[model samples]
Target: MTSIKPGRAPSFLGGIGSAFAVIFGIFWTAMAFSITRHSPFGGVSIIFPLFGILFIIMGVVNAVYNFRQATQKNRYSVLDITDSETEPDPLNERFGPIIEGHVFETHQGDVEFEAHDDGTRDNRRPRFCPYCGDDLGEDFRFCPSCGKRLPE
Candidate 1:
């Protein structure tokens, strides 16, 4: 028993080549018939039609194989995010701790707000310094990493 391993779908080039082979096979068969009808040779003339038939058979077999391979579905199950029990976190799972910053203007002037990794923006102070990206544990007048003064 022969087991075939899973493979990718047939490429565009393969399909085009198969189609050309079938067309060429038909043309060859037609030409063979015309040649045999006009030729005076008896026994040897039979080989021409035999060769044409062989070409047609090979071309048809290749075309059918390519068609079947192209249409077969993948063996593995596709990943469906919606079917999962819990929703996946895009920012935390994919990006790994990304800080999205937004600025708003009020009567007091431009105010900067940092969006946490949980995708929430509640006017909380930025956890990391904007200049050096160092962790800001508490309110500070300056960034300890780059020694830059924080904006008042």
Candidate 2:
């Protein structure tokens, strides 16, 4: 029903997770140091220091990873609700067809290009459906608007 927008930034949950990881890392590292230096809890298990140190390392790694994710541009961590019924002829209605060396059509209609001196037109393909002219987003095998199967 929903998904992350393309080229979006990270979600707020990522930052929250990163903050938790950093706090946990600091806590465990301090605990490990304390356990190794002066046994705060008497008769503590021999593995307490090792376990604390291991968790400290893991937490630090997780923090860094989460922080990096949170800072990425256009990389969202949540699904966003979208309307499938977008304007079909948005480009044709707005900018119309552009006439350069090639006839660069807008987003709504088919794009036509003129032949260059090398007797070849540009091969850049649109991400939308050439048949129904619908945006083919990231994970669809078929066009939602029309029942056309998209090329993989």
Candidate 3:
């Protein structure tokens, strides 16, 4: 099995590039506005401001996207695959003692036996109700949620 390693967050270089773009956009827009106000160029001057606005919008979007990525807890978009097949399942690792034929104790200090057993203490209960996709206990003769007869 292939194991995937967590990847690095969005680089600071990207943020720097975005900042440069926004600065250039602001400068370009200011220059365009000043030129249009003084010169007799008329409607043609509108194109410069529009291009500047486009650059500003693109830069802001890129910055915001990078900021969100940087703030995320799991920045694992880029995965490094490795040939490590012996990794344990996370669920099993968490509930190993309870799942290994041991009685589980509730928060209220009540111990509950495995519900899904066929008299020999082996957990043979169906995990889910096929009809409605609801979770099922081991002793269920029918789906409680969907009221469908379960397979024997």
Candidate 4:
């Protein structure tokens, strides 16, 4: 398998789309004015509707493509609560052991944090480690390699 690096959205495509949107607005306004049979904006009146339509189509296509790029499999959007447990639930009391790791999932993948903690001398903050909970160092807020935020 191949790994993909996270990168920012392409600015070129956005610039082009934004340009089209602006042109679309201009053409739409001109066309509306022309259909009113009032050529107030001057000479470009003849192709107003044509430009308007072209711009609209291009702009829509660009938007769709950008949306798709933004939602790709490797992109991380937010955290999800995968599994939880409560030793016992009492009225007005919270459920579960302090808190456990989340079964993180992304569009293209999933990551599991195991509790690999020895639970004795780990000076790290409260977090989940694969075997027990001893593997994670407290210096970082999120997993340094995978970017998973340590559960509070």
Q: Assess each prediction's global lDDT (C-alpha) against the native.
A: 0.60, 0.58, 0.63, 0.50
lDDT of 1 by residue, 1-152 (tens): 12344344543345557878878878987888887876777865677877877877887777766665666664322343221114434544454332354532222323446565677776766567655579876778888887967656
lDDT of 3 by residue, 1-152 (tens): 33353333434466667888999999989988877775567776787788889999999997776665566666535454321123434554465425645544333333335644444454454467644679988788889897977655
TM-score of 2: 0.34
After superposition, candidate 1 runs with Cα above 4 Å error: 1-12, 74-152
Collision count of model 1: 0
- RMSD for all candidates, in order, please: 18.8, 13.8, 15.6, 14.3
Select the stronger candidate by lDDT from 1 and 4. 1
What is the per-residue lDDT of model 2 for residues 25-96, given as tens digits with 9 covering 90 to 100? Answer: 567657766756666655463456556566556666655655565566545435654322343445545655
Which candidate achieves the best TM-score against the true structure?
3
State in Å the error of residue 141, model 1.
55
- lDDT, model 4: 0.50
Q: How do the predictions measure up, each by TM-score? A: 0.40, 0.34, 0.42, 0.30
Candidate 2's displacement at residue 54, Å, is 2.3
**Residue 23 local lDDT, model 3:** 92
Q: Which residue pairs clash within candidate 3?
A: 116-138
TM-score of 4: 0.30
Q: List, residue by residue over 1-152, the lDDT tens digit for candidate 4.
A: 12343343663466467667967766796766568467666665656666677676777676665655565665533333332231223421334222344333222222333343553333333454432344567565666555655555
The per-prediction tally of clashing pairs is 0, 4, 1, 13
